[model samples]
Target chain A: MAASDAEAPGMRPWILMSPALGAVVLLLAIPICFILVYSFWLRSAVGSEQVGFHLDNWVEVLTDRFYRDILLQTLRIAAISALLCILLGYVPAYFIARSTTRHKTVLILLLMLPFWISYIIRTMSWINILGVSGALNVFLLWTGAISEPLQILYNEGTVILGLVHFLLPFMILNIYVSLDGIDPNLVDAARSLGATGWQAFLQITLPLSLPGLAAGSLLCFVLGAGTYITPMVLGGPRDAMFANLVFEAIITQLDWPLGSALSLALLVILGSVVMLYTRFAGIGQLAKSFR
Target chain B: MDETTRYQRLLERFRNGDLERRTFLTLLGAASLGAGLTGGPLKGLQRQALAATPESVRFDGWGGVVSEAFRKYAFDPYTKNTGITVIDGTFASGDEYLNRVKAGQEGEYNIFHASGVFDYARYVNLGYDVVLNEDNIPNLQYVMTALMEPFRGVTGGKLSAAPYDYGTTGLAYNTEKISKEEMEQKGARILIDPEYKGKIGGSGDWRTRIWYGALATDQDPNDIKDMDAVWDAIRAHRDLALKYWGSGAELMSLLAEGEIYVTEGWSGRIAALQQQGHPIGYYDAPNGYAWQECLMVLKGSPLEACEELLNFMLEPDVAIAVAEGQNYPPSLDPTKVDLGEKIPELPAFDPTGKLAGLTFASPAYWNGNEAEWSKTFGRVQKGY
Candidate 1:
């Protein structure tokens, strides 16, 4: 239609997309805006929340040393998990991208199989394998590998492992999509010019696949940062994350205003990470990864 | 169609002139009233309608088997006796259910197992609680004295809730791992017990953790407002704990799998685990953590039917059935309940006459300073 009528208003095309756009605004924007408003409301002494504007909740979130630590810890965990996902996911993704089309379908299916089950069930399975009397311990004892059971579950390390385990597939799929788009001859050209395998990959395939790497790492980072269950179930006391604090404020403590403030603070932190990444990698580049 | 309904007989008698028009009208008005104002002739009709009326009462309860047990013991039988079918809904937390009711979204559920006794205070403060009609709940006479009393005494003061089930929270151990005698000596202080290093477990409920620290330190749990003292105590005992758990199921899994030798838990959950064939045993510590779980009807709810439901739960047989189903100590009068076999340790565990002995955490006391509590406790749990 636009090709036929060059003078047509851009609004006509947007009208066609309005239904999807309306849903995004309704489900995402309206709720986030509401949370932004509630962030200023006050929580009363008796655990009842009222609609009054105040900065106390914000001050508590931003100023308090504890909230600061939790926020920083959340960022730290997400960054590490995303970095690990990139490292772990890149190999399988590259191999899958290099496979025959018939094999690629089976490989991708196998990669996505674990996700068919619930996320919580997958996390609990880790508990069964990692806990003191869990499968790992029983196996180790049966093999006479150690005199005592190892306390592997409920620690910072286990929390990271859980996050990476949940997120590895997403990272793999994203990287594979970008890697699969590359022309196979580009790397062969470098190899014919006497470039080593590592050098050819570093110069050609890696640069081309940067879009997928950025997209997958960003996805992993966002999910890892926002996760509530993995750490809560597998990690010890110190493993409590920003989501848990938000959970307590709204659900347990009945302090919606404070919870809303905490939620917005988390969104700001996560949003800024995306924005900063976009500044360097460009949003257009990352969006093209999905294509 | 075989014998027609009571209304049919009334109509036949009226048409035959055996019944006066005034009498017929009065009878008709009373019959239509049903169980609305639950006293007098209307109630007798309700007893007749108990098997087939379309009227149904809904209960929002904690989910999983606990909700099923509530249906089997209290709800299902009540429906069978009275035609009012019981509709069941499940909730995860008290604040969640209260918020739903407060928002006017849950018009369907009148009677709710809203958290513990502490939450009852919040309900009253929030004006969500209805003044219970003790006349309708005659069997409240059999309710435990401590729960029935004025504001939860032996009796007489603005009763708003029917205390159903309560359990003790304190140090428990795998009997195969340690004797009760050894556990008692450690008591709540067992959190810091060196012998159980990396073997202790508890959920991350600040109130119970505070009570644990208070009991261990010989301080009144309810009296303390700030968790500074609570956390300091827990920090000292931090080494004994594995990690602060987030859910009962998580802690139970730890216990059931023998991941931990000593467990910090609630008696309700311990009972659940024991039924699953775990050798779980609670230490009868002198100072313990206890909360009375009550069923509260929301204000402006159908009071007549709600009160009757509460009263039915108080009956000796019904109370025992509930007690057996949940494996929690009956909140009704202990004398009325037969605790012969289902849960022998319940009576010994719950302090019917000596509620004062246990550290009762007040809702008012618990709500204050949660942010600070979590902040301090978070650091403490990390051994900071």
Candidate 2:
């Protein structure tokens, strides 16, 4: 091939990718750099910030037992929510993938409907469902199942529940795409060879869909861990996550420097998880599910 | 050299044919653009045009009924009288709003209805506080001297804000669960009462929590000799609390829905609950949190327009209507301005106008300990 011909193919991809790369650099990378710079500054007694190269915020964020506890709690909540999403989402995903109905598009459309409403509104809707005078208690009262309303809302459980609610669609869609891509002949062959339906699913279908499941798990876990709103709205005082600590530091304490450090700390930890997932499962699988 | 002399020299070079026509034109264009961008006559002209008539001024407040009152009485009428639109915004707390203001560009936040003298002091300390031309705001005379004194104390005897309203973070209890007599007797101690475990509620704000914690420990909130006792008291409240409600709406909802039997709630919010016929009672326990809210004009606001709006808002009719609407007493000294019948009936109304009964937060003491205490409270709140 000519030198120009060889260069054209390589340059074409770069030219095509430039806009997206520029956007990511502008929106994500630049802000992160600013946060990294801000993490070293100091917040004074009167809430005024002193801009300098100081390690107080970093030292505190690294050494503080309080931040460590909240980080662990955040990870625990995110993992629980991701597991719940997988458990609840997989059945729907499989059913949708295998559906012979003409209204399969409608099912996918219905799944996307929740995204139209504001996330804050959706998180807050739990209040109407689980509040003392809410629908659940009233229904329970009418059914004569209990003497009083169950104090079910505003706990770690509700925070996880809210996370699952917000994240289930992503999980379902990812798994559904994976299941849809699976060859019917593979499952049919497994069954034809005297394998039972469950065995066929376990061996042929489930193993093939692992990439999508991993992708969904990563997305759900990252989103859940990074959420401050779910805990602020649905969780009790003790149920605050790592994001809530960043929020309190920045907003309540007016300690932007500390908030920056805390946020970076969270990003680094979550980034390690992403790196591990990429190393094992391959990052291309995540892209494949979207495609 | 000065920009003017440089511009003249460039013009002379251009006219004398020492510079090519294209180069002269390019240089002239660049110089004009630079002057425009870097604050020359063009920028001054833009400022003059904007000041001639500001199209809109933003006014952020605590939202819910408070915002409704401002929208109905103050902002809507102000817009009607003058064409300047009042852009109504809301914040969950002063801290949240302050952080937003810090992140935002100048003039993005115009005026805020801020609570407490500490908030005013913080703004002053951050240099966001604007020295209002009080002579333009004729209605300043009607505001209580006591309310204005604290703000003046913060800003060195010049007001950055007009005293808007006053209320307390008083003990609000469910009348069905706890009697008025019990609330009055138990006072701040009702929060940490073991009998009300899992049934109690409290504000999530560190200041309010710490203030009540001080009262529960029987230590003066303004001067705490033992910090550990306050933290312990707060920890006890945290253990017992059903949820530390974040906003006025949440506080009202918790009480109205019977989620919590007792909480330290905003005086206005609790009054709103009472008016909604929720059987909620309010009591100003000894040294209950008495805070004054202000119409603080921020540094980069349209000064003359903001001053005029401040004056209009403080008008007795407007102030009284807002007071009745929000269920908070207007800062219009009841003695100076004949505040309507309902004004006196509001939760924290001080008819005497002296405000000697209400105990306000000392700005110096609170702001001094703000960084340390707010962080500590954040830890203690999350089960430290």
Candidate 3:
């Protein structure tokens, strides 16, 4: 082949890149641009939209103590859920990684089984099991474990349970991939030394696994923060999340500008958190953790 | 030669009379068929030839036995007569429907059935809707005069909506669990009553408990113009409420499961639950419940088509069908309806010309203040 032929093959790069680039520009960039434009607009007094542009919506959202408090609450809930997922997911993922090939596949599939059903259905199922007259209470009463049914469904506990149930699989899957990639000989080498089991594992395995744990925690936190259905179905009225407020803004109040501002605020916060994670824990390591 | 000419002349004469008789017969037939054929098609063609023709009549409203009944009896008949299709869209809440309208997707629907409480002057101000054509609705005259009076244009002769269904917001109790007498004895103050504490389940809307608070306190519910009072009332009963159900279906399920013994709800919903084999009962307190649900046409609908549908829905038989089907009392002459004994007489709109008014909550109250209200209620309820 001539030099021109090699250069012609380079043109194939653009050809391959065009479809994804076009899709991103059309689907993501354009909508985000529209939302950016709307976030600065004013809401009509009579309804939810106005014909004029202003910084009122942003100022209101930024300065309002109510929105600030909810934002904090949302972050707190998400952080807690992420921490819980990490603590709960690590052991199972490590076990799965150390298992035989067939056992590993079965264990991974078991972790993934819940995702096959809808998240909403899974969340609502808790109601059937935990509600005032639901199965758990009925069973407890029948067994003489309690005189009256317990009020367990519509509370923060149920919300957390639902979040953990929906998100733990993703965490486990990420951590499992990271652990699977580790050389078993490294553990043997550590064991060959005077290092104890706990010491070797902590010094070698845990630090190396931090990238995967961070990546898993990030996924859980972003999802937990953005989740509306689980909270709406499982949480009580007082447990309304920031996303639910955004939903009410867009769907109930028809305030698109404010809704857009709220959504963008959430995105910015999540993006910042991800950026921070990327800085502290290399993004490349995070990527390999999912490999 | 003379004999031949005479024979030819007679033959010509016979041919002319036969042709004349055939022409006369055709003319007589066409004249007799005139009213049925010419008037019908000609009028239709004239309507079709109009400058602006609606593609269809989009009906955005709640879905249930009532809406279904309205579609079957009223909406279908109108479409059949006028060649317009009724597009049915169901909403889980008034807020949801209003959101669609506010999004400027009002073009997707031509007619919307909304609570009169939710439809304020703002809708008119926003150019989302227009006044109903009185000329097309002759049955508007037959609508119970009380229901008609409230919907008339505020300024003068212009009217924004046509009244269709009227029912009071009252206490709905599972009759199997709680008796009618017991509910009535608790009266409008049932939610706050120590006996019913934690047993009451309220619809998520703030209007239900707010009005009940007004009634229980002997203040006229209609006169509750202050927002503070409404908030206070809601906060007071927040502890007593089991949950704020977002839909009638959810409430019905709760009632069926005996999770809720009593709660404030629309009479139509109670009636619907009763039909579904749930032993639900409704009581009309002395303070009276809110009356709502009116049909309004979007601003740009073909006036003639909208008027026709509006008129058809207002017809006495159609009203009765909607009421009986939806479990709501019809806003028409009760004597004209064969409702049997299912409808209670005391809760019925006073047909005797005596004016009994009910309090209503406008969407304006919650439009801007929902965030604040939600925060306030959340804070107070959480005891923060």
Candidate 4:
């Protein structure tokens, strides 16, 4: 019976893992390999794909100063967006975590409210609010807040605002779950030992919630980096993101090989950042915090 | 023994004497009968199957009142008449829709409403369009000669598209912002007038901006194809430019907001805005504007059905309805429609008319030098 029990545990884990392993290999690994292979192909003169191994695409990306500048700009915008999400999300998440059961449920629902609507609708709603002749401007003009309409619709500031509005719920939910998982007894114990409220929070609660913060930051950063629609709708031509460039390369120019190379470059950058976060911060703990 | 042997001998004689030929004849007769029975039923099944499957036509082009009118008149009528469905895939810009076709989703759409400038030789080379049969369309004879001649394919033996509607890209402005006296005094040269600096809204289209710059300086647009002249003119008038709008909708919006006193826009869209109570007015400049827009059928369609639809679209009443509905001038003769107050007076395409000399957008100019031109424009326009 004891020997059978040991075998059962081993068999159970393998049984549970098979579907997940199969899904990852089929959906993720295979497509990624295809993209990697295509990245080495060449683009034809007329912007069509030529099926041959060449380093020209990679070299172009590496040598072109415009591409490099855009890449750096994308990274900077993504980082700023992620940092903003963290700042805006923390207070609400903390409040929700410390709230009573009913309040906590309401707060969680409020965080998820925007997700009920389509992402496109939510993004476009900003246009209605911020356009020169739109609702907000009309109201402001009626109240005599300003003489002329404010130029707020198409710019970097509005793009970041849209990103934050889209991504804040994920950050808050992740952080809230992490805070909820912390034992109340530990906090009481810390306070009972004469530690001040700030000290208790700094040494205990903050450290405990680090996993959630890391997870939320990773989610926000990757999403912001890969965002296309928000930036396209709200941003000017100069504010084109890396994803938009990839889209234009493949769809507009019909240069699939170059698009593959650019996509892989983005994936590698995002992967390295994730790996770095996992090294110092525990990815498993971060994932668990979301639950 | 004697009786059994006699019976067997008689049967063997019957089997050996051309019996195989007789049996083959009988089988052939039966096969023919079976085919005769099933042929009509098979055709019925095919018709039913086609009926069960929804026949859908997709219209891809710029979105606004024009697209809305197409949805109402062309798409809806086509669907109602043929029991087919219509899909309205409205694009914000022509370049974006062209990109979609380039991405090899051309076959997915049944029809494309493209501007002549946007759909070029590359599309033809890629086999993205179908040749239209003039015989199938009785109304083909009524299309304006100039509008019909250009799309008559490489051999001039076939047409790749039918003339839907034609309009010139011209100037749209707020009459409230820019006085009529000033416009009359300045004429086409108002764009370059140094006194009215920082009060103009130009389109983001490279061709329109370049041509406007050339015409403003009293230079022939066709001769000013060089990037140097284009950039120089833009820089000289940079102080006068308020913004560069990417679409007619954006131009109208800017005009409504009073941010732009005068700007480049389509006459139809400006007319639509005026009808909707916006303070926008349009003018055909003396140096002339660009004529654009065409209706092309997708390749690999049911040719007979598409031909029928094309013919239906070109009917005099249909043409008038489409023109009146979309705010574009009908390509058919003016006598076809009763000139009510609802229809705005549009300039005639006659050579002697005030808006006689018009240039169409050419793909060659942008396709070859977009990067350089965009860079120059970016520098001079200061990134609008």
Identify the leading candidate in terms of DockQ: 2
Per-residue lDDT of candidate 2, residues A178-259 (tens digit): 8899889999999999999999999999998888899999999999999999998898879999999899889888999999
Error of 2 at B12 (Å): 25
Candidate 1 steric clashes: 8
Tens digit of per-residue lDDT, candidate 3, span B157-210: 566677777777788887877787787787867776667766777766544555
Question: TM-scores, in order shown?
Answer: 0.85, 0.92, 0.79, 0.79
lDDT of 4 by residue, B187-221 (tens): 66776677655566677666677777777777766
- Higher-scoring candidate on lDDT, 2 or 4: 2
Better of 2 and 3 by DockQ: 2
- Model 1 chain B: lowest-lDDT 10 consecutive positions: B45-54
Give the alpha carbon lDDT tens digit for every residue of B51-131 in model 2. 434789888987776677778877888999989999989987788899999987556688898889999999999888888
User: Where does candidate 3 stray beyond 4 Å?
Assistant: A1-15, A91-116, A183-209, B1-55, B74-83, B138-142, B154-156, B173-190, B193-200, B213-218, B225-230, B260-262, B274-281, B311-318, B344-357, B361-384
DockQ of each: 0.36, 0.83, 0.24, 0.31
Q: Write model 1 residue lDDT over A26-52, tens digit each, in one string.
A: 999999999989889887666666777
Model 4: lDDT equals 0.69
- State how far residue B208 of model 1 sits from its true place (Å): 0.6
Q: lDDT per residue, candidate 3, A1-291, as tens digits?
A: 699898988899888999999999999999999998989886666555675678888998899877888788888888889889999999998999888776666777888899889887888788778777789999999999999777676667778888998899989988888888888888889999978999888988888787788889999999999988877777665676789778877765557888889999988988898899889887897887866
RMSD of each: 7.9, 5.0, 12.2, 10.7
Q: Which runs in model 2 stand beyond 4 Å of their true positions?
A: A1-8, B1-53, B76-82
What's the TM for model 3? 0.79
